[model samples]
Target chain A: AQRVTQPEKLLSVFKGAPVELKCNYSYSGSPELFWYVQYSRQRLQLLLRHISRESIKGFTADLNKGETSFHLKKPFAQEEDSAMYYCALSFTYGSQGNLIFGKGTKLSVKP
Target chain B: DAMVIQNPRYQVTQFGKPVTLSCSQTLNHNVMYWYQQKSSQAPKLLFHYYDKDFNNEADTPDNFQSRRPNTSFCFLDIRSPGLGDAAMYLCATSSHRESYEQYFGPGTRLTVT
Candidate 1:
């Protein structure tokens, strides 16, 4: 069974401060991790994936195989960055397109 | 623009009544998925269609059903709505059935009364 755990339910930070959202996964096979974001009055969209290794909106996540973690980080947070972030894991074997998501973390960037 | 679209942004259904949620995509993706997201919880996969092939989760209740008439459209049918069934139902599409980046719709909020 593939499982994703997001430790924080709510994270508050001041504008221009660094922010990190923790995520951990438990999967036997090679996992494909992704970060999805949902802003107020917006649909859930893919922020980035471990395979892409590309930063989106100044946010980046590194997948650590040894620690089984994929933490999302941003050097400087903006007030518009306030949103709900979800970490997801995917297994290619049986459930191909289905994503196992973690309970989302609500990020509040105060100005 | 190529995107996933879900109909009826909000739905109100009576308990024990059947409700259907529709999803369409202009992306022409081969895979479409349905997910149930409860308040403060992650979106859980209910089922998916890979080029017309239906795959349902093992633990998904029998009350839930799905239909894929074609590549661009899919529907989720809830045979009997319950209080617990009230949640945000999300529809997503991807180009492939593997680990491709998925495009999600603005989810349909279902409220059972």
Candidate 2:
């Protein structure tokens, strides 16, 4: 079956510390991957996508095909960075845009 | 600015009562989706409408139904509310051909009592 997995339920870190949130997927065909974040009392929003190969808010995610991983990384974490992060995968069907998401990881950046 | 919108940011429903959640988008995207998310869990896809075509996920329960009567609006209907169905109902929209970044609406938090 096609699935995304974020192993850590919660990751707490001090401000200015480096942080990494791991995400792995299981799929047979090529799939588009995305990292979404939800801040408290805010809507879930797109953080970044693997295809873009770009960084947002000092965060970057590298898609490692050999290991089937697309872990989100930030060299220095900030208190405002605390939020719920979800890893999602989308595949091209005949004409539908279906996304399968993993149980998210909650990151708490302490001051 | 173009964005997705969900009405009634919070909803309260009695057990066995029916509730409807509405969403609208001005992005002119061809695909719209509804997802159910509980505390600390992944957002589960309930269904989506690609243009005028409706697609439902296999595991989605029959009690959860959706309607996209037009290009700009979609509705999620819960036939009979149960305590377990209380969750954040998220509505998202993206381009038709590709599942690019989906623009999400401020979700509606449904509370069942």
Candidate 3:
């Protein structure tokens, strides 16, 4: 079965500290991965995709095929960064398929 | 800014009552999707419409149904909502030409009494 796993339910960090949100996947075929975020009082939006390989809002995620991981990282955290993050695995390798989402991790940045 | 919109951000309905959630998108994307998210759980795909073609998830309950009247709007109808049916219903849209990024609405929080 194809699935996405977010090992941590919550990750708390102080301002200016580095943070990492781990995401792992189990899939028999090539996988298209994504990181989505929901900020307080805001809609859930796409944070980044493995295909893009670009950073957004000081955050970056690298897809490691061997380890089956697409961990999101930020060198320095800010209070405004607190939000719920979900890692998703797409059914199709082409990026258009049912998105299988992980339970999600809540990141809290303390000032 | 053109975006996906969900009506009645918060809805309260009685048990076994029929309720409908509305979603509209101004982006004119080729695909629109509905997801059900229970408390502290990941959002699950309920169904989707890709340019009038409807696709339902294998495990989605029959009590739930959806309709896309046109390119810009979609509706999720719960025929007989039970207590367990309460959840945050999210609406999202994506363009076929655009790389897999989805634009989401604020979502509707449905409460069953």
Q: Rank candidates, TM-score, best first.
A: 3, 1, 2
Candidate number of the best TM-score: 3
Compared with the true structure, what per-residue lDDT tens digits does model 2 show for residues A1-111? 999999999999999999999999999888788899999988889899888889999999998989999999999999999999999988764345577889999999999
Residues A1-111 of candidate 1: C-alpha lDDT, one tens digit per residue: 789999999999999999999999999998889999999999999999888899999999999999999999999999999999999998883345479999999999999
- Looking at candidate 1 chain A, the ten consecutive residues that score lowest on lDDT are A89-98
DockQ of 1: 0.65
Q: lDDT by residue for model 3 over A6-98, one digit each (tens)?
A: 999999999999999999999988889999999999999999998898999999999899999999999999999999999999977664556
Q: Residue A24 CA error for candidate 3 (Å)?
A: 0.7
Ranking by lDDT: 3, 1, 2
Q: Provide the lDDT at B26 for model 1.
A: 93
In candidate 1, stretches whose alpha carbon ends up further than 4 angstroms from where it belongs are A93-95, B97-99
Compare the candidates by lDDT and give the number of the best one: 3
What tens-digit string does per-residue lDDT give for candidate 3 at B24-109? 99998989999999999999999998899999999999999999999999999999999999999999999868864789999999
Q: Write the per-residue lDDT of candidate 1 for residues B6-106, one digit (tens) a residue.
A: 99999999999999999999988888899999999999999988897899899899999999998989999999999999999999998744356789999
Q: Please tell me the TM-score of chain A for candidate 1.
A: 0.96
Which tens-of-lDDT digit does each residue in B6-110 have in candidate 2?
998999999999999999999999999999999878999999998898999898999999999999999999999999999999999988544556889999999
Compared with the true structure, the alpha-carbon lDDT of candidate 2 equals: 0.92
